[model samples]
Target: MTRRHRAGALVLSGMALVLTACGSPAATDTTDAVKAAARQSGDTVYPAQVANCGRTVRVDKAPERIVSFFPSNTELLLRLGLKNRIAGQTWTDQSPPKPAYATDYRKVKVLAPGEIGREALLAARPDFILADGEYQFDGKKLPTIAELAKLGVPVYIDSAFCPKTTGTATLTATTTDLTALGTLLDVQPAARQATAETRERLSAVDKALTGRPATRAAMVQIVDKQLYALAGGLYSDVVRRAGGRNVLDDTVPKGSNFAPLSAEALATKNPDVLIYHYTGAADRAASEKWLRTHLAATAAVRGNRLIAVPAADFSELRAVDGTVTLAKSLHPDAF
Candidate 1:
């Protein structure tokens, strides 16, 4: 089965990916984060031992015709140049701008964006399913991991979403996951190469921003007239990695990254940058002009630092893209 994660840090009803940049609670320090990321990814040995949601699965050989659930998994697959192997996909928050593999998406089937469409998933006939976690394989609505295993389709959950708690989701975790996927698909060399490039890109951001003071950021979401601030998880991670700081200091659980806060509090804080995760369904339009009117006295309004990032990019499986996007915005000189 599948769970859509774009409803401002989606919290599902069943076993779900709680360890993501969305509903995750742990905010471990840098050292611990790398250790956890390394433990989960990096070595895709034969009989590749992969674990998820308290269970372990062995991948004896690379899988062909994979049915991926969610845009993170789907996009990661495309980055691996494995588009040909993806039989079908589901749940995208936003389509890629100028999608490089346009033909590849055209060839596959799509399930629902918010929930699993069991019939369509089964019809795709995948040899493997690149799932997010145990919560997604709830078995009742969609095929459980056990059910798929029984049918000879082993589910490969993203280990980044496996741990019950994690420090902050970082480029280290993203590259590790990316590397592991490449290894699982029998392409460690390519994974390593890509990871090296990722390292370089992150380093470039840091180097370009050495002397600049850290930018203070306020991540906000205005959906259905309600005001919420993006708390921890991927949003926090991106801010930290891009050489800025998340200024929405609150007692919100890392699980529910969205926290209801008064407009007065946001205006008082007056962070240097504003990131609004806009959900398209809102009746009233939200935009830069709207932000300026509401936060006229704030630094974000005065500095013109409002940045719009698609919701999916917040706690994304592939985190570097959002980091790079943010780095360019926070410190334009970094790019």
Candidate 2:
């Protein structure tokens, strides 16, 4: 299969659907119990919708009208074949458009947290809301989870990109989160298929790299004038699984998810492979020019082995589709 087509398949095959429900207190509990029972029939259990910052949330029903605050979460919903269900979204999210929803995106609805307040959200009347963790939610001055719950709307905060973490991450929460999504969406079989297929693809890549000397790699995301380095957390885990050695395994100078590094410092490390991540309006030419201009001293620049990866997949390191997207970008040679 072509890389893009394979990527599409990879995303579809490893789906996770997060379901949320809200209503009267007693009825909500009863519905939650029934849904939980239904989910138990599958291999995995439903994950508790924990509190973020200081808000507690418990989602029990399948949300009919959903609002996604983050781009990755929106992509996740789109990949689960749930585009029709997404009622509204935030513009800051940077995921690429899925063909399935391309024509309908404009019609779905757009609301900026920076401009519109919780009242705008309430007006949308979403049964469930997916937000960009507690920090952004608080920063945007939106209603707290407790307040949303009081209004009978359950909010799920994305902690996949939690800033407090350090070093290479395991992605345990990511895996469980996807399974939880499956149960919520009533797509348990599809979710299982998606997860298993991802494991298989990763295993195949690992087998291909077996016994070969590991290539030292550095994951760099470009943000304006500076380049942000991704540490060995969930993002790092995917690189390792695809058969690469993260050069920053030992560097803990700053926080883990993203670290600031000088161009000279990168040259000193002299990695065998360099991966560049870009978001809006970036292509191979842009990536190569950036490397030649700012990272000329690096070994990858000298050898011409630098690769520009789509910035969309650089943030959260969960979901089968993302793994597939990254695998194709990092290991095109293996395929």
Candidate 3:
């Protein structure tokens, strides 16, 4: 069957499975129903009070022309097939952006990274703004969400990537956000389909990894010769769901706390598989050189078992791409 067909079938199954998880409710309103579904499926839900970007805001309606200051949220927009609705996004997508989706991405305006000035975003006139708390708008001092709310733009933080809650029980996929986006944009069916398909695809990868010998994996992002190792965050969770062990899973607390490790430390750990997040000037050839020079002594480099995932995939929404990449890398022999 086609991927879409299989995805549709899987979504139906997941909905049926999730329904069984619904508990007796004191409240049966739409808000309660949405919350219950979100909790049952381990996903983020909307119309909920979320605090981030230094403000506590309640999402009232779906947004059109959503602006995202985070790369992962950019990928999420595309996944929901809301390319037409995206007004602007951060600059992270330019580096080795996925070729197949370039056409879709081009439709949206590309905003400068770390330059989410309220005026800049306000010029685009976005109905909603999605960003991680770490992103500083206008030299890191202006256009806070509460400030934007005053401008009549509802800002929603990407809670999935929030450093405070990431890698904790509170961490959930951005599916509920997708659903809310659907409602906001009047694309409810598309949102539901994307959510179902995304969940189903990840579930299949999880199923495929079942009973296999758990293998070790590591995530390293290279930029300008600096190798920043990510521990347990969105991408680490992707590694786990893909049925591989993350070498740095316990290296730090939750969020994007990158562990600084030298080549020697990497060699000592010597994971079975190496997954890289190369941002700039590091193509496959450059990655090979870096691996050979820094970790040639390790089993991963020696066996040529290294995979380079795009930076966009490091974010929560795009982490699905990372999961698929890891799954294929781990099971390449099957091919």
Clashes of each: 5, 12, 1
Please give the ranking of all candidate structures by lDDT, highest first, separated by commas: 1, 3, 2
CA lDDT, every model vs. true structure: 0.66, 0.61, 0.66
Best by lDDT: 1
For model 1, give the 10-residue run with minimal summed lDDT.
Answer: 1-10
Query: How many backbone collisions does model 3 have?
Result: 1
TM of each candidate vs. truth: 0.74, 0.73, 0.75
Best prediction by TM-score: 3
Badly placed stretches (over 4 Å) of model 1 are 1-46, 132-135, 254-256, 278-297, 315-318
Residue 14, candidate 3: Cα error in Å is 36
Candidate 3 to native Cα RMSD, angstroms:
9.9
lDDT of 2 by residue, 232-331 (tens): 6766776776667778656535446668777777778898788877555554466568767887877787877786665555433233445565565556
- Write candidate 1's Cα lDDT for 1-335 as tens digits: 21112221222322144445467654444444443443344434355655444666657767778887766677667767787788878765344422654566655667665567667777778777887656767777777788888887877766545545332444566675665577667556567777788788878777877878878898887765567887666567778778788888563465545588777889988798898765333422465556778889998888777887765564334467777788888887656
Q: Model 3 compared with the native: what TM-score?
A: 0.75
By TM-score rank, best first, the candidates go: 3, 1, 2
